[model samples]
Target: MTPTSSDTTASPDVSGVVPPTVTAFDGNGDVDPDATAAHAQFVVDGGANAVFPLGTNGEFALLTAGERRRVVEAVTDAVDVPVIAGVGAPSTRETVANAEHAASVGVDGVVVVTPYYYPLDEEGAVAHYRSVAAAVDVPVYVYHIPSKTGNELSLETLGRIAALDGVAGLKDSSKDVPWLAQAIDANPDMDFLVGSDSLLFAGLELGCTGLVSAVANVFPELVVDLYDAYAAGDEDEAQRLQSTVFDVRSAMKRGPYMAGVKTALSLRETDFDVGGLRAPLRTMDDAQRAALETDLRELGVL
Candidate 1:
């Protein structure tokens, strides 16, 4: 059931596990809308609280603007859950346009990462987010992933962005728990979702509302289980599930970042094919796959 204009509503409580979903491609390396939608539905049916298309794991960097919009459109149409599209680009104008396009496609929100390639100061960062928030009616989330983007969102910058009227939340991928803690302290009303699955337990401990994990692409239930257990005050259960998530994550990290996630999805034997990583990132070789298979078998995730 594809969501229409009327169905585009912001998620009131965007807490819990949300997968930064992967992009599915055809044998020709073109974006496969059918496969993309199917994968989105797969994750939602597997217990994803929301589906995050066009995220880092989704190869947002490699896709063209039209492809990005199509990915969002397909994912939003496939799932009943909220769809948060990653609209981050190299420029504010592009980012704003992407967010606006995503909004038109019926996404519940857009996650904008800091501009990469060029370093941005606090003022520039604030202005970038301000422009995007002003350009879109849907919720805008600041995606703080410094390692890839080379731009960091300082606490003051986060506070400024949070003050924007259309800004809804933040996704911290910095992996710096202390910085995330300070950002949370700086903006008490803002919703913070961690990007690293390894920090799911720690992020929860630090009052994070949710996690935007790559590993969730392979094991949505584990991420959701950890969040649910923690939310239910089952500390022991959360810890156990987190340990399992860590195991799976460790296995994937052994290969190229996003490739391993796609490979694992393929190994799971889902109805839709995740295929290989987009160019510039190669799929795992036989040896890497064997190691990952060994890890998955030992953990019983396969």
Candidate 2:
């Protein structure tokens, strides 16, 4: 039977800048729980309302199941703020297992990306989410990133998923504003999070309550300020910061995909040694790093 959206209340406040933090690794190319937890604390201290580990920025697909569980434990233990761990996997069974483990570790919620690599129809998509949502007691936030997942949830499908018991909200990284607008309009009870750094302000303007931002991983203050400005009724400041974010996003894309955030973190004067991206995901080369430094310095973010 298809479960309808239960009157399960929303999860803890996830309504501000939530950084999809990188999973910190050590010299041995293994998960460094302490370092990973420390990074989570760093963002919370930097004004992030919450921390989301094991997302795309965290390289969730690359980590082992045990490693992902350790990250959830470490981050949840390290910070007082809510931790929304990414529990998405390629299969519904794996996603349910991940979500159950995350909930076991006291994560405030789990963000389940749509099953990826294989195409899914609306019914399959809804069933996948329904299973995950039913398996865990914690709130489930659907992660809609078609660019990576290769599965896009239609508005009608999203509505059905939103109705599932324990399904709390969604993070739309689809970058389709019209679809996002329609989804927001259709499900006013569910919180919508904008997943792209480029669409933060516009997403908030469209009634999104929170931002699941990659840029926030390295520069939480920038994104937090953007959210605060909008909440404070400072539209001009919000837009100005959004423009700045556009520049930062462009600069971060200077190197191979998903490398800039870690590179930028290393470039900062902080004591964080996040090691580097796992194998097959290269870091920024010297020349690209230099260019990113120049861009950030010009923007006064360095």
Candidate 3:
């Protein structure tokens, strides 16, 4: 299918606790479209400013191309907020295909990560993102997570990529404070969404537009409150909330990251049956769950 034009003029103003939503599954281990839609709605109702479907926490790597498109369709249909689909694949062609599919489905933007498995040089990374951005008109947020992609996008290379026509902003999961600081300083026009919940307050203090936090999948209201408080200039409240959020994040990080998210969601008042993680990613053991529950209770999230 030909890529649709995303001439939506204004760049999407996406910010604040956009959950890298988990792709809900049924017992059969297939993508449960209805449950996935319900989960998206669940988070939005819980106070997410936007929905980011098929991201790292959503297990984008495990999903097939068709599943990826379908997940975006379901999420966009379910939420009124901007849906930024993660179209990062190991190859440029696949990433472009995913971006085209996201555009065709009417998602507001696409988050394209560095092509993984095979490390790409600065020029290769720039070219990869440029081709994907040119293939569609929708806003593109460069996803920088060298820890997972094995290709660290340098500040210079990132600047070049940000200058692309359709590029809108960046989501930095790199956790490299110095690099993030440099990127923020160099690209004043870009909207930087921090991917770590632990950095929510710090990121906001650094002038980050918002957070794309995994913890939001479980505690959307708290995450939203922290962002709102900080944005509202309520430093004391934001600081308190950030500390509590840090504790919750520490507990979740005790297990497999995404599985911990799904497990935590299962305990919430959600309409979706967010089954389990995809293959090779198992749920937390009984002891881990018990410890997590205790921590959540202490944090008043249970």
In order, the Cα lDDT scores of the candidates are 0.85, 0.90, 0.86
Off by over 4 Å in 3: 1-8
Superior candidate under TM-score, 1 versus 2: 2
14-96 per-residue lDDT for model 3 (tens digits) = 87779998898899899998989988898899899998998898889998888888899999999999899999999899899
Error (Å) of candidate 1 at residue 79 is 0.4
Off by over 4 Å in 2: 1-5
Q: What is the lDDT for 137 in model 3?
A: 80
lDDT of 3: 0.86
Candidate 1 lDDT (Cα, whole model)? 0.85
Please list the residue runs of candidate 1 whose C-alpha ends up more than 4 Å from where it truly belongs after superposition: 1-11
Model 2: clashing residue pairs?
A: 4-163, 5-163
Q: Write the per-residue lDDT of candidate 1 for residues 180-242, one digit (tens) a residue.
A: 999888777677898888899999999888788888888887788888899999999999998
- Best candidate, TM-score: 2
Q: Where does candidate 2 have its weakest 10-residue lDDT segment?
A: 1-10
- Candidate order by lDDT, decreasing, is 2, 3, 1
Selected candidate, larger lDDT, 1 vs 2: 2
